[model samples]
Target: MAKEIPQILKGFRDYLPQEQLARKKIMQKISEVFERFGFAPMDTPALEYYELLGGKYGEEGEQLMYKFEDQGGRKVAMRYDLTVPMARFVASYPELPKPFKRYQMAPVWRADKPQKGRYREFMQCDVDIIGSDSIIADAEVIATFDAAFKSLEIGEVKVKFNDRKLVDQVLTKLNIVKKDIGNFMRTLDKLDKIGEEKVVESLVEQGFDRNILKKYSQLMEKSSKGYVNQMTQLLSGLGVEQMEFDKYLMRGLVYYTGIVFEFVLVAKPEFGSVCGGGRYDDLLEKTTGVKMPAVGGSIGLDRLFAAIQEMDVVAPQTAAEVIVFNLDENLTADYLNMTTNLRNAGIDAEVVYEPSKLDKQFKYAQAKNMQVAVIFGPDEASARKVTLKNLREKEQRTVDLANLVAEVKSMLW
Candidate 1:
């Protein structure tokens, strides 16, 4: 047998203290923003039924799910995403009020081939609302997404918007789709990655006609409101168009019905959509026979953390404010008393390690980043006084025992 070794599986990670601290700070700020928008926090189990996992996430997502059969032959799978599980929750218990709003922060699993900024096990921050069919729901989701990105101080993000119904109308007009929606959609979704010429070639391979291609070529070229206005003038219907420029916004038929959108960072335009979601009017129908409308968005928390770090949006620095150096080892109780007092006074403090030489102890104190050192040596012990030294400023002061806590507080604060 080969030599035994210990290691985490591929596509998994171990976050050290500092790394976790940075990620937590980012999550905290995101939570505050979500709360301000009236989204209440909620949670669910990591394990759920295999039935609950099926036919919800997109085909690609289904392929990446971590599924298994348990000892009793019960089929189960780790939750793949928050949105589908949320849909199940609504159906399982329908007595909840309408327009349900909630935010979930949890880990999701995928068996994806991992690469830079992509992982098999990662966290997602999701916000969703149910039971509303108004356009304001669309507007509110867009506005909230904009606000969340803006609050995070991320780079300029343009949310490309579209409606699947509109695209279906266009495809039907072109006579390109009939029971081959998946392949056609997969081709369209690659429009961002592979250019238009190749997509046309692929469509031609599928036996789409020259006249149909030519007509839609003109349509796509009109990637602006001006073309939208022409479509409106030619047809009899109402639609919207604003700032329609070069946008790679087609994720092709992904369960979205009306008002599909994607959030992409301008810096690394090739990293693909950083966040994406759309309106799904028939989510809970799997759980409940009745159709309930819904809209939501997800922040690829792990990917965003890595990408933002590359863009130099640094996480906040979090460290202990003070360390209490231990001098006069016999006065250990006194040090503990002072440590507690400092904590009560709203200061982060910890006592330095001990039973070492005085010089070594000082070095250890410096290593632990103690700002102020208090000495209760024998001389001060006999005189009922304490010596406090400001390690940062190299200043020393002697104060009577009664005022030791107050004096230390005044100096540190």
Candidate 2:
């Protein structure tokens, strides 16, 4: 038999419990916020027909799609993002209510070279509202994310946004032809990465006059004030405090037709935008042949997780809150009963199946970050009591088995 390979492909990962729990915690917080705004849960296939996803993401995005022919000789590709597949979904099911609001948390793939906080495969926590073009819809999306981050205790973030319409206006005023607006926006999106001088140089190389490039840059610097004031008032009314209007936030997606926003971690700006999305009014019409306005945002979950880790936000090492040590093989039944009672009382409890040494069991509890450890020796079992130890406080107390649930609950709380 051939030796099996023991490695995962580049840009992919296997999430063990510790990492997965943190991600899930973040996702749960995000989902709660999404649902609070009346967004319903949704799911879509990981793979879609190539034609369905093709041409939606612009030239660079197309190149980064993980595309291949399937076993049936059909061209298929892993979804690049949740939004495109969402467009297909709305088109396929016209029966879906107008102003459809949905939240989808799933993995997306990209073939782009992986870098810090960037990956070939990662989870996107997305929430979208379709069939609504109102600015209120945009504000609601922003507010939901603001609430999610606050809930996650990820510290402060600024929701920086810009209007694509304003960018278009600047382009028109600068005599940038319609044929080149897409390329111009794509170039402008790199302003933060390459700096203003390099952006101007790149545009000049693309045949834009030096004077026009300078004029465009000047206009970009000034055009965002009025829009910023308007959005600031709107978002403030919704309790979203930190927002800024950045004229250069031209999100790279060609589909965006209106306001686009990105969440920037104030504490760690080098991690880049942890979340971003924009309005894509023409995309649904383009994909489904039915014109409907839509706007959305996605939290780059892996990146956000990395940021949390970098910030030293402590996450629980294990889901189990209470570990019941099997101190004696003969006392297995007692241990199981105690664990069962704790679980029945809505506490997450685990019991050692095999008898283990006292020190080893305590070490396991500590390693797992278990809050409480219950030991049921023959003495305690005979007395119908258990020794409950608080791993965090390093204290122990004897509680009657009848009151063990309440005692553990109190300690955990």
Candidate 3:
């Protein structure tokens, strides 16, 4: 028999302890912002029936979806994004309250070719407002995006936005036929990536006249000024100052019916948009046979974390705050009791399973980036006291067993 080598599929990855901890912290911060804005947490499965997911995404998205028949011979597909599944969720539960506000943090799969920040499987932090068609709803979603980045302290971020209605007006002005509008918009979205010359070439290849595309290129600069001014005034009260209009921000989703916005790190524009989403009023109506309006946005968590690493954001190496050292095997039960007491007082405490050399235990605590260590040697036990060692400061002090929790708390905080 041959031994197998460990492997993982391409475009997927396993996050080590430090990276996962940072990612969780990022999610928690974003979730907190969402809840503060009155959005509640909810979730959907990673897989949905093919019929439910297929054709919802535009052509490009359809190609990138992980779809196949299941063992039961039922067509199933991994969710490519959270927005579509949210539409399905709303349609399934018709009795859900009006103006639903939700936040979901979960993994979504895409069969896309992996790149520096792009991955086949990644977590998305999403928030949506359903049932209201007010412009305030759109502004609220954008404001939430701004708040999330502010909470993360990821430096300056600009939430660029443009309305599909405005894009439609531009397309109509360019004499682009209704049938070609969607394809034209999708191609227009590539302008920032491929540049205007190539976008013109692409649209020309798609049978648009050269002169019209050239005119379209020239009109782009002036097209967004008015809308940008309008949105800035609307978003004034929300404390969202880092926003502007991007004529090229035609998010490639087909369901978007109104405004679309993207969050980009101002200091690192080349890092691309770490989050993007828009309004989709008709998404649920087609399934539930009722008028439903929704607007949502998602943070590309993996890509955001990658940017965070590159930007040198401080992150903890371990979640454990303190480790209880195992000194004497006979006193293991006492160490366990102290660990429990720390935990009961809302501290993150860990105890070594077996008695180990003091040097080895000290090294373990240091390697885990623990702030403090609790040592209960026979001498301290006999004295009814415990030694609290500040790992980083290389300081130690003796405290009564009754004061263990307070002493550790002071050391950590």
Best by lDDT: 2
Ordered from best to worst lDDT, the candidate numbers read 2, 3, 1
> Which ranges of candidate 1 are over 4 A from the true structure?
1-5, 209-214, 217-248, 355-413
lDDT of each: 0.72, 0.89, 0.87
What is the per-residue lDDT of model 3 for residues 1-413, given as tens digits with 9 covering 90 to 100?
Answer: 99998899999999988888888888888999999999998899998898888888889889999999999999999988998888878877878897999999999999998987889999999999999998899999999889999999979999889899877777788878889988888888888899988988898899988776667656766786776777798787898988878777889889898999998988778879899999999988764566799999999999888888888874676888999999888997898899899999999989999987999998888888898989888899889998898988999999999999988989888
Supply the global lDDT for candidate 3: 0.87
lDDT of 2 by residue, 1-413 (tens): 99998999888888888888777777888899889989999999999999999999889999999999999999999999999999989888889998999999999999989888889999999999999999999999999899888888878999999999888988888888899998888887898898988988998899877676578768977886777778888899988988888877899988999999999999999999999998999998888788999999999998888787889975676799999998788887778788888899999999888986899999888988899999888898789888899999999999888999999999988
Give the per-residue lDDT of model 1 (tens digit) for 371-391: 677777678878988888887
- Candidate 2 weakest lDDT stretch, 10 residues: 208-217
What's each prediction's TM-score?
0.81, 0.96, 0.95
In candidate 1, position 379 carries an lDDT of 82
Q: Output the worst ten-in-a-row residue range by lDDT, candidate 3.
A: 212-221
Q: Weakest 10 consecutive residues, lDDT, candidate 1?
A: 234-243
